[model samples]
Target chain A: MGETSARATHVQHGSHIDTIESVDAVFREQRKLSFAYGAVFFVVTLAIPAMSVWWKSWYAVPIWGGFTANYLFVSLLYYLFLWGLSWTYIKKADALDERLSHMADEIAAATLAAAEGGES
Target chain B: MGNLNIIAIVMVIGLTVFTVGLAIFVRRFTRTTADFYLAGRKVGTIANASAISGDYLSAASFLGVAAAVYASGLDGVWYAAGFAGGFIVVVLFIASALRRFGEYTVADFAFGRFGSSRIRLFTVVMVLLTSLFYMAPQMYGAGTTWTVLVGAGMFGLSPYQTGVVIVGLIIMFYVMVGGMKGTTLNQIFQFWWLWTAMFLVVVFAFTAGKFNYAKGLEEVTAENHRDVKTVTVAELTADDAALLASVETAMSEKGFAEVQAVVDAGDPDATVGVLIPAKNKLHTLRDMFFNEPGHRYNAFDQFSMVLALVLGTAGLPHILNRYYTNPSGSAARRSTFWVLVFIGTFYILAPIAGLAGKLIIDDAWRAGLAPANAAYVDGLLLKSDAIMPTLAQILGGEWLMGAVAAGAFAAMFSTTGGLLIASASAIGHDVYEKYINPDAPEARKVLVGKISVLFFAVVALGIGLGIPAVGLDKAYPALIAMMVTWAFAVGAGAFVPMLLTGIWWKKTTERGALAGMLVGGLGSFFFIIMNILKQLGHLPSEGVLAFVGSLTFPTLFTFPAALLTIIIVSKIDGQLPKNVDEIWMRIHGTASERHEKELGLDKVSTMFGNSKH
Candidate 1:
């Protein structure tokens, strides 16, 4: 088992040309997802203040269950939105990691095969 | 002590003993520095999530958020939203990277990243300052809890002083003995207990009060007027006197007589007759009871508060330290996800409790159930912090009050434990082990950490005792909440910009980090000082100084300023460390990749010897 693992590490080290690019691709993808989710969060949260300033009377307009839009939004819906955003981000980010790892392994195997073929 | 409720005292004692016992049980496992500091990096998602929730939900969340909601309606919910919203930012940007770049404390990370002792020292100062500021409010909350629970001082101390000392000592004993492993377990237990106790109180309140959400909303809103007692009257100018006369003329002659007598007696500001809310056009019953922003903040203030809270979570040292204990970067993200769930559940219940306090306790007080000396001003229960305890007593009698009181202690104790550990680690690990004695053994480092815990606890106790004497207790009605915002502002200003830049910007130099921290930390610190002075009447209250001082949280300005400073200074410095790329790889790379790079396959295999091949 030790000899097999050592040979695997040697192969991985010899064919590391595409690893940096693969890692960068994953990082960029993750950053984009984070930014997109972050923008949505900021817009929803900042709207509370914006509506308060620009449309003051809207607060008094009753919404569901006799709660004014501002009341229900601040008290209930805001928390729900946060929880949803987190759940989505975690799922997507984890998938991204798994994809990146798979890509790394495939790249290493292809590189190893090419190196062995060239040697033969 | 005789005036202290027996049930509350017993409950408080029992909870304290239970926490101490848990700490003692975990102490045997704490044999190494890693165990003492990061629990040997063995914390799982659920345990760490609960610990994070316990650490994060301080007295500010437990008591202050409810009281704010009770006082300001929807404006109060903004506090809770801002708090939980901060973690979203954490989940997106900071949590995983922080765990991957794992260090014992924030200062350690800064030092490792920048490879500068000066940066490390600067970070240590900021960490200590932020921790102390954060801990101060918890100490005050503990004091406030005792005043409501026991009603008397112990061992020649005032009740507030006695409470602060007792909490500080108990926390010190546990944290010093158990370290991270023990403290984390204690926090998990405390969080659940507090959550369950609060859950029970809310259930009881909803049932006992027959609080139909729609009807309660209608009932509160339909009563367009609130009764406010005159706590103090501003001196009446000629115009004011004219206004008073006109107001009095509008009232019945008998009602006017009471007002005239107070004005005639020369101290109109004295605690006198109640102001009929119907007389004030600005405070219609609809506005008083309905959710609105202007109750506590204008649009600008509301925006600034949300900004402070969202950015500030990234900078809190206690919260940041928890990320270091995760086994992998992925685990860190999972834990943050759980933190969001746990905290969201807690926050959802907070407003329920606040509404119950308003619908039940404050309503009863207005209906003549309040003690004669209990003050009500501008629709505010003066002892707003006591609303939860009062609600408990009214709904389910002494036993419920005791339960709620125990929860309050749990909130304070858990938060204090986290803060104490953060500060002690800064002093012992960052300052002592890293600088003073780099070759110190693990046992000696742990010993030093224990001493640091004791020293800081005493300091916190002293500052807690002085909070009331400095008149903060009177100047700020929501004293706990106010101090907490200050801590958040300082944290956001000082740490957020540096951490963000260090992680994302390759050009973040040691010089830039130091300069940004100074600009942000000291800028917010200055604002806090000015605000305090203005509140205590040392500064003019009606001019530019007052306006600047009134920007109680300077994060809205300081955060941008700090970010700008870092960008500009890093541009000017035009230098990056050689290892910046490697560090970036560590921060953004997978845990498997990191293991491959840092250790060969042999080491990796050895590290995961128990795992399946």
Candidate 2:
């Protein structure tokens, strides 16, 4: 009887808390990857204006057409940046879903605890 | 409108049936706010990517860019480049963050970030202003199509007015019943059909001119530079004999003298002229490029043009709101990445289509089969905007013309639907919920939102119809682009800085947020006033260069000013209320998945304590 009661109590314990904590490691990794991606994005967004300045620079030699090589180089860089971001987003999203499911559990647990405390 | 082309009528009926069918199909899926707004946030990357592309392409991209290119020359490609690059900026900087932060709308983000009722009210106003401007042009463009294709004068109303009512009513019906789900499904299908039609039209145009493409282009180029060829004008008299005598004398004497003198001088660039017809005069393509009367490209203006595209993407509320529809922040991010691919691919085809139109028209003119060839200089692209419509007529006759017409209508309708929804939600949900009826039932609140949508849709339709009555039909795109820039400038200047700071910075306060939003909003508003002045002839062209040109540093100028305003005001107001970090974390840290599932209206309402019972 005592063993049965202990199992019931365990089942009724903070299952959500346990689930969320279990995937904390994955969330940590995802966060790190997201930040890295963010940094790259910030750099590329800045590059467009940077190239605008580069386009009018007096000292650069014109390549192919009248446009300097910098214009084409920047365009190619942006394209690659986009390609890289797309690749990373797909790979990282799989792990992110696991993290989010855990987060939902945590939110549920916290809400339950707060309700219990309010009633008490 | 008795001039209603049967093909156009058929296409419109087809579109309505398709949209209604989708609405009926998706109705079962929508049970709550989440369903209404985000499609239950379960939209897979590919479908969502296509929908996003459909939404982003707008009338501006579908018809305007190609037309602008066809009408103008190489310079019109700037529009295409700026627009396509906007998607890249969206994918990288803003989409994921927005999805992660906001639950229902952008106003939800504004409210959550600052916990200020004032900020929510301020944001709603901005939303209304931006959405109205964005929507007006789409409605106006629809009117133009109706007039040109279907003929005018229905029930004592012009074609423009009839078009306004017809499109507005149809769209409102579908949107009211189906919401975002309806919009997405219709947009995706329309996108597919539009793409197919565009592809066929382009292929047929190019194939028709296969052999002639090369020869025609060379001849057109030669003809374009015909003004440079050596020729002389003899100043014709009224009588034929007098004109002939004058031409002969001029050719034998002064013309040869001037030609010999030029040869002796050995000026490589200068032309030595011989006698020509009395009416015809020499002109060069180089002269048209450099000396043609209009705004020439300058480095800063060019830079600002690009900068507007990049920064403008960050500020568009309709685009920002799409992120919230995804199931997770990562999914939202992934969707944006997919959008980059979809948009990039679609945009690449547009230039090819533009080129095809260019070649086909040139061929027809060279074959002496076209009557209008004499109107435009040979080798010069006619209005780039006319390429699609002209190509449609060339390849498909009345049937293809009808299809192109339908595509244009779809493009305008879908974009208008998205913009209207965003505006209504901002006003009804944010403004009314916080201040007007804080304790209102969920059903009542939704009713108000619907009413707002109806109201705005009507207002937009009215303005669209009215614009044509005022004779602004021909200038719609340029006017729309200009106003859109104002919306972008304001959003970039005001909302972006405030929201970014609120999310990322710990020191942001209610006072600072208020001040920043005001300054950014007002500064852009003032800039728009100057733009309007220029458009209306109150301000001279020179006045614009002096005053408005200096403020092209939209974000850079407004950012520092808003930052300073916020910091100073906040300091004077003293410390902010407690629990700021917790609230900030609550908003910023919510995963997209949790929000996605709760995207249902019931769940969202309950989250905010909506008393459904």
Report the error of model 2 at residue A2, Å.
27
lDDT of 2 by residue, B333-409 (tens): 67777777766655545544554566666566556543231222343232233455556665666677778777777
Error of 2 at B63 (Å): 1.1
Per-candidate TM-scores read 0.88, 0.73
Candidate 1 per-residue C-alpha lDDT over B1-613 given as tens digits, one digit per residue, 9 for 90 to 100: 5256787779879998999998888887787777787777778788889999999999988888887777666677777888899999888988888887767888987887777899899888998898889889889988877777777898999888888999888998989988888888888988998888778778987798777665666556665434333334443325556546444533446555766676677764564543333332222333444455566565557788888888888899999999988777777888998998898888888877887777787566656664232344423466567667767777787788888888888988888888888999999999999879989987899999999999999998888989989988767656787788888888999988988888767679888888999999999999899989988878887899988877767887899999999999989997777666566655665634334434543121211112221
Q: Per model, how much of the real contact set is kept?
A: 0.44, 0.07
Number of colliding residue pairs in each model: 2, 19
